[model samples]
Target chain A: MAEPNRSKDRLALSALGLFAERGFVGTSIRDIAKATGLSISNIYHHFGNKEGLLLAILKTASERLLHELQEASNQPGTPIERFKRLVQTHLQLSRGLRKEAKIFFLDEEHLSPEGYRANLKYQREILDLYREHLLALQEAGEVNFKSPTIAAFNILGVVNWHLRWYRPEGQMSFEETSREVTEFILHGISRVREP
Target chain B: MAEPNRSKDRLALSALGLFAERGFVGTSIRDIAKATGLSISNIYHHFGNKEGLLLAILKTASERLLHELQEASNQPGTPIERFKRLVQTHLQLSRGLRKEAKIFFLDEEHLSPEGYRANLKYQREILDLYREHLLALQEAGEVNFKSPTIAAFNILGVVNWHLRWYRPEGQMSFEETSREVTEFILHGISRVREP
Candidate 1:
């Protein structure tokens, strides 16, 4: 990456860390500059203000997640398979973008009004990705439910919360944890004796 | 309630609103006192400090939730019914205590260490309530999943995230939304044709 791109990346990453640790309001521009070794002017030049840095983090995180979810949803397979792939992709992204994802979940209140509106658009798109596939699966007689949107919300809920407790050094690897969580969700825990 | 009790309730409620809106670090004791119209000494006399107020809010919220979960779990019914009731109680609580629940979900990072540990004990009891019921239901062949603890977490994720987007004036009432969300979890969106 070019120097500017690298500096921007460093600045964004530092902002994510500070926002996660100290909160968006609690964290200051000087804190970000100090963390990244970038002057306050350079930081402001790249992003207009603290809110701008936050917007940048939200945009980058959501865009990357949206792209991955789209790809996973487009994969050729059963509806259940597509759902599983979406969950797996979500788990991987949550791991890779740990700080950014945490900030996204906790810092939405800090987004300016216009940024929040735009961010909601991205959020709806990601949700629609889940809802559309769920609708298809329901129509095809694969998964059974009354509301596709609620189902999508439930599905997203299961994976979005992984950022809180999912650990890299935990006993269960991400793959195993994802598989177990996905299975538990789809089939539930009741033992159904083979008919 | 006694005069002191009423004043404490007002102070704690005001603290919850401020904590949810401005965050723990952002909202000061002066702000809390101003919001409650309580003098700083009165506030301090009731709760030693800001952390005391926070701990009180957390303790009250968790106790109420834990009590409800215990009641719902102990209700005489099948495993599925108990699970549904748990979901219903969770929905109602989430609605009734919106600010406190939001703070519970988002402001844990600001809790003092002792508060966090006590809060974790309450959380564990709530989770154990879900897990034990799921285990019973699994043994009864009512629901089928691999891990009880993971299954509980999945169920929780579905309801907990409602703090983010659940709207009171939206198309669905809390009753209707809770029913749909609960149904989606139990049956999923996959349409399974009856054999």
Candidate 2:
């Protein structure tokens, strides 16, 4: 049981790297098998097909995000504090799961209609978590913004877009970058008295 | 001359739609020609090859963005005003060139090394434009933030990200949505007096 689980992990990790570098259509099952030193049959047995592998990767990443966000939302804090925790947790998870996050954004279109819808559902749930927090902040008179839906998407854009440009070796460490992002977001949405 | 230019525009437009819908590797020269009613050799004649077609599309989009951003930067205003114009221009152009923008983000990895570097330069220029405005704002003590580089990226992320979720028939008109985004960004970066 342990051996099979390890092999499955290896296969998924290798496939994630290839898909990130090449793309869903460009990376074939043979490519995954070659990268992982596993048999094509084994790849099939594990993921069923290329799309299946993509779904598995996306599902794991999405579920992890949803879980973390749920925990963040449940924590006791002011609306501002909870929102800060939510942003920090999101940035940390996104950095930790960088490649998976990239595929979640870029390769999602390749999923079959059913797979696409399922992935989108996860996305919507993740988004709703953000929206819920923003709504709370609005009710608390802590944040000012139009359209919770648009505000939620804007916050996500700021956090998720880092996947394209953030590098660990760059000047700012992950912790520093996370703090900067949180500051920008907090100030961006906080209520301002008329000048 | 006019006939040839029209044909080229058609070819590029057809390829742009196909590339956005299908991954670049998944899209063939034959597919573009079929969609455009042009011969395969004709596509080659106009753009040299598929990579050439991709380069042309990216070049157009990048140049247009650069031109608009430059114009916005040069307009008469404070750093904050210039930044507002810049953001509005970006959202308008992105919404106008939705498919091309999508390809510019997603299919850029497929370019040759030279093409990739060329595209990166344009992107850097765009970033520099954003950075310059933020730096000016920082100098004037109008905005509070760390690392103009990350600030610029966050702004772009917020603006560019509307490509994914914004819909024409949705609740907000393009003008209304643009206003909401610009307002969010303005508040996000503005300096707050300590309580």
For all the predictions, what are the DockQ values?
Answer: 0.41, 0.64
Instruction: Report residue B56 deviation for candidate 2 (angstroms).
Output: 0.6
Residues B1-195, model 1: lDDT tens digits: 446488888888888989888678778888988998987786788889878888888888889888877887688987778777887788778778788777777777767788778877877887888888778877876454566776777777877877567888788677777877776556421223234
lDDT of 2: 0.84
Which residue runs of candidate 1 sit more than 4 Å off their true CA positions? A188-195, B188-195
* lDDT score, candidate 2, position A23: 78
lDDT of each prediction vs. the true structure?
A: 0.76, 0.84
**Which digits, one per residue and each the tens of the lDDT, describe model 1 over residues A43-108?**
788887778889988898889889987887688997778777877777777788888777877777
TM-score to true structure, per model: 0.90, 0.96
Q: TM-score of model 2's chain A, to 2 decimals? A: 0.94
Residue B135 lDDT in model 1? 84
How would you encode candidate 2's per-residue C-alpha lDDT over A65-167 as one tens digit per residue?
Answer: 8997789768998778888889888888888888887777887667789988988898899899989999998888856687888899889999998878898
Off by over 4 Å in 2: none
Candidate 2 lDDT by residue in tens digits, B113-195: 98889888988998999898889988988676878988888888899888889999887888877888887888788876656
